[model samples]
Target: MLKNVSNQQIINVFKFLEAAWSTTQIRSISYEEKQKKQRTHAQKMIDMFDLPTKKKKFETRKPFDYSGDFGELEPLKDDETMFVYRGLEDKFKEFPQNYSKVTSLEYADGQEKMAHRIWTMQEKFLNICKYGERSEMIIAQKTIQIRNLKEHCQKNKKDTLARVILLEQIQGRKKELKKLRKRDYKRFIWLLKELDLLYRPHPLYVDLNTRRARMRQYLREETCRIIREKINAVYTRLDSEKENFYTEKEKVLSEIRKDLSDHNISAYDVLQNVRKLRQERVVERQNKAPPTPNTYRWIQSDKDRKKAERRERDLHRNALVKKGMQKLAQSEEAS
Candidate 1:
């Protein structure tokens, strides 16, 4: 993301570059001074970008991040229908989430098959396709949804939590005497898997995926696409807001740098210098290690697992928050 600046500044830089490159008249600029002039030009653009300077101010939390996956962005296309089905194959998993706005893969065989949309191209129409119908401004896509998954365990009276309590009463004999018939082994395996908590997908998602597609599959895809667009709009708005904030901040940063001029770094110059210092150093690997065989290790203690998980979650959250805050602050300032 760009640091900050205004639309006007952007215009000047663009115009300067155009003029400089046009017909090689080159504005009679010196070769040695070219880089310095470019820097000044860019800084002017940044400083001139109009940003908000009101009571709303910069934000400390709730910044934005890249969300390309959510948008169904993919590599360059194969053949047209091939690209379409590839999209379907690629995003069948997402259909259950009601996520992607573009699905060329015809989705027939119910929403349950959203896990793997199988299409048979013959004289017969293969499957329900997720297509789009574009209007003047909107492209409507199909949407698939699961009705409901979470009914209270209290109402059902047969929850895992209850079963766990019962197992505890039997005194840690988790490998209990199920003693089912050999013929019913598969059923027992299903029951066992259903009983496991961590292994399961979210109940709501599972419910949605398991259900049949009530609406046309293409309609579902189109709906998902629309929703995806809405989500994108929200993020784009946030970006614009942040852009405005950063543009506003250039002047403030410049002012602060002016106050510290005795330190030998002008605001823009110091910033550019900071950018220079932040460049990554090329590293050469010296310690080459051989691949090790996988070993079956026992699980860590619950406390240790919990601590590690907590730490991981905390770090991830902190990273996200920090990024968002910085973006939000700069955007607000630039605006």
Candidate 2:
């Protein structure tokens, strides 16, 4: 085969091999990694003119601190939530006692410590011979459980179930306490006092939690703020001008005095007449006292309404007695 092969044929074969190698080499070339592209002119134009796209965030306002309205209020120095049981540990020696001989809570197991706490609560809040089913007793039990669970949660952050249970317990306790308060206020007071708990009742109306409501509140606060600022500014301006105003008043008084002299009237006699007029006006005002407001009628509590009625009755009786005395004095004068 080599003996019969022409130079052209051999050259053609070599050319075909070179072409195959070139094709293989082209196919073997790997793809380059994509790079970040520069922004196009159109994209830049859109960015320059178009509004930014963003999530609509809810607007919230800070509630005004009305605590400052109370001038002499003292802030709590210690944690009020951590209720301290007052009395000697030994004094809790009676019926419904924790029979556990574990003297030190430091060495006691979780269950034993919980039982001891419940026993202490029962000792303080439970009535004579009453078991642990009372609302107060239940609240006390749940409170202890919540405190323990809170401690556990702090130690083991992954205990999500405990946290959920803690929240549910708190909500349930709150509802129970609210019911107890409504059903028997005196009992509620006693329970609160024993537990050293602050009774913060929920608002009568549910908060709408809408933007409109928030905006309305914000506007009302703003209006009040503006009014107060304007009033303060007016008072400040008045104070700055007070001296000049008093000087002008003196000048007017002197002119009035001169006029009185020209009219053959004595200033002393005039002042005495003015004093008598003022006294008579004051007496008339005292006799025509304003009637009592019925604002107390808006109070929903029956006890409060009764008390207000009693007060009004007393006031009416006092007024009648005062009128009778005045009439008797007039009759004596006529005699």
- Judged by TM-score, which candidate is best? 2
What lDDT does model 2 reach? 0.68
TM-score of each: 0.18, 0.40
TM match of model 1 to true structure: 0.18
RMSD in angstroms between candidate 1 and the native structure over all alpha carbons: 41.3
234-285, model 1: which lDDT tens digit per residue? 9999998997899889988787867878677556777787776665321213
Writing each residue's lDDT as its tens digit, candidate 2 over 47-91 gives 654433354799774321211111111222221111233344444
Instruction: Give residue 85's error in model 1 in angstroms.
Output: 56
Given candidate 2, what's the lDDT at residue 65? Answer: 22
Give candidate 2 regions above 4 Å deviation: 1-113, 126-133, 152-164, 179-200, 204-225, 268-335
Lowest lDDT block of 10, candidate 2: 64-73
> Cα lDDT of model 1 overall?
0.44
